[model samples]
Target: MNLKATLEQWRMFKAVVEAGGFNQAAEQVHKSQSSIHHAVQKLESALGLTLFFNEGRRVTLTEAGELMYRRACYLLDEAHKVESVANSLKSGVETYLRIAVDIIFPPEMLYKALNKVSQDYPLLRIELMETVLNGANTLLKEGEVDLGISPFPLNSGFSEDLCEIDFIAVAHPSHPLHALNRVLTLEDLKGHRQIVVRDSSTERKAESGWLGADQRWTVSHVRTSIDIIRQGLGFAWLPLAIIRNELETGVLKPLPLEQGGLRKALLFLCFADGDRLGPAARAFLGELRYQTMSLPSVESIAE
Candidate 1:
């Protein structure tokens, strides 16, 4: 089984589509325009299908080329991942580890786990993606991060019960809602502003619960939402871990909702490529599991 086209040729073909034309693609790949053209031509000949057509002063994908371009993109991405795996293997104990941890996962716990892992690999470089909602899962699916701690249940990949986060509806003690001095209903919040956090996933944006209120304020970070609520600007359901200080200090008070005052989500440890677990990734995983050994989980939430 001899493949006529090479990964280099496919990369140049993808470059042309992404860069908008061969001239730009040439500049991007740091190669001559003729070389870029030759590579695309070779790819077309090998595949026996025209991938692009020259129109007036612009180059565009042919009907068949559109499909091939998509296929080529997948091929190139997988090839890049293969190289990444190889690099990890060649250099034992990966020098860099990309991690995505949902903000709800207790920042203090996360920092402790990271510190524990760093003790063994002092030179490890870590890229921490503090995501909200579906953000961690998005990065894992896109191969952007090696591992993640997410609240969303995984559709694929290896996952284990990490911990449970309690979300409570709270507002500033001075807010108008507390003036009622009685149990509140969903309808009671209709006229008040609800501070909501934006889902971090650009690929698959989703909503968890919508409290149909007259006013809504969407913020990117939980800290921002909490800050707003602390000022009596609005009310929000914030993670107990993050707002514990505020709640204890009486800066934020719980809203007496009719029911479901406490919302609990079980977070999971996610591994993008669990099959090829690198030493650095495995170390982080172990540290996380070790730290969460006594934390509350689904069973505790039920009780």
Candidate 2:
């Protein structure tokens, strides 16, 4: 079969269908209108069917055209995937890194760490998938992502505790709870409206299954939740790393919780038989550990 010819015709037909006319398709595909017309004509002849109903200035797909469009789209997408894989193999470029990340590392920290690693390993490339918890476990186990940074308890057997972020409840100084220095009991917060960022995963167990869940308002991200806390909307549990600036500036104050402090365990994960992290991912993770103060000794959460 003339595969190249079939592909060329498919391209022309798709361009015409998407661009709404032969002339427009020519402009988009950088071919002459006559060339596009000829290609589509050849395609129809080869398929033994009329693809479109010709009406002046408007072209509508025939029944066959509709069916072919669906199939053609899948074919092109598969072709592109094959091409991408071929190029990666030929050039020896690492094409994708499926990663799971805790929302704990805000954008700035994540970028800085990645930047440092990219410096030494220029050929290394990445496609990162970020999630708050174990959402990316399936991809990691299936070897889709090279590694994932998630919180414990991890779904995969091959995992290591990479970081720890102490959780601190904070509120504005003028808020009534501020005078208490640190109200270390749950009862202290019962009377005041609380703000929380909800996480359904096991890592978010701190806030999960709370009978007091209704007393607090929920926000989607830490930054926004902290912003509301600054405005004195309510007190919230936040990572100490994230609130350091606010604490120093007196924009926010940590409340005394019942426990000495709330802490969370962060884990780095890979498939049980996965290869060691490439230079880039490894370098980035090393920097991440340093920046987040997660280094020195890696510890497991108490059983």
Candidate 3:
């Protein structure tokens, strides 16, 4: 039994179980409240237990300090991602990247691949994050982003495809389904009011391209379901490159759906490994695959 626990006594027992004691974990680890109570009393006397209990001045953790504060927060987040990939390979790049995207992925090809990675990595630091459907695969499965375009195709990392995205089903040129729009159907959009959007996945909640209308309305951005269907307050399905100027000037119209109002999607591009990416996430994923090969596909949005 020679353990001698340390990562500075599991970072002073996770800063006194997240600063609830030892004088606010010695003012949050700046040390000395008698060195964070002698490093959590030498990590509970080298793990013989009794992690925390005193309630008078508050400090509660105890079931072996909630399993050693969830394994010392996964060993201090894998030792801060091994000191952030050894300071991004000794500062050759990636001082920050993040990404995430997917708000129908095509804001002018993500502003021309972030204006050519800010004129070739002008000191990295990107971040971005938009998100919507599967919300960029829930921020790349919660590593909280480091590249993820997404539309679907993720089942565990390194995807690619990257493009497609059409959708249409609009409305609002004086709504009332554009005055009995000639092609409209699904029982004339089951009594109007659809909008939708939502699904930013906290863990589940998804509903894509809804038709279950019974006066729907959800909305959580796709530019707030195209500004609440441009104020006519309904009919949604957007992203024809974000309603190409509300379908060119008429301020939105397209509901001629005798079957389904367009649709396409695709998109991909995820990450999580591309050889442990860096150098500004491999130069903004080679300018997001050379500006997603000059977009406009899905048979040019079905003509």
* Better-scoring candidate (lDDT), 1 or 3: 1
For residues 27-127, what per-residue lDDT tens digits would candidate 2 score against the true structure?
89999999999999998988888999878765789999999888887688667657755665565535344566666655566777877866766666767
What stretches of model 3 exceed 4 Å from their correct place? 1-4, 7-44, 47-62, 85-91, 94-98, 104-106, 109-111, 118-137, 147-176, 180-190, 193-195, 198-202, 206-234, 237-241, 249-251, 254-303
Predicted structure with the largest lDDT when compared to the true one: 1
- Each model's RMSD to truth, in Å? 3.4, 8.6, 13.0
lDDT computed for candidate 3: 0.79
TM-scores of all predicted structures: 0.82, 0.57, 0.42
Ranking by TM-score: 1, 2, 3
Q: What is the C-alpha lDDT profile of model 1 across 198-231, one tens digit per residue?
A: 7899877755444878999888888888889988
Candidates in order have lDDT scores of 0.84, 0.67, 0.79
TM-score of 1: 0.82
| Model 3 per-residue lDDT tens digits across residues 1-303 | 666787878988888888888888887667778877777787788777888999877689978789889989889877877877777778776667788887777788788878788788787777898877787887777888878887887787678787787788888889998887487788888788898777787877886788888899886778878888888888877778767766777788788787678888788888865655786677777888888787664355445
Q: Candidate 3 versus the native: TM-score?
A: 0.42
Higher-lDDT candidate of 2 and 3: 3
Compute the lDDT for candidate 1. 0.84
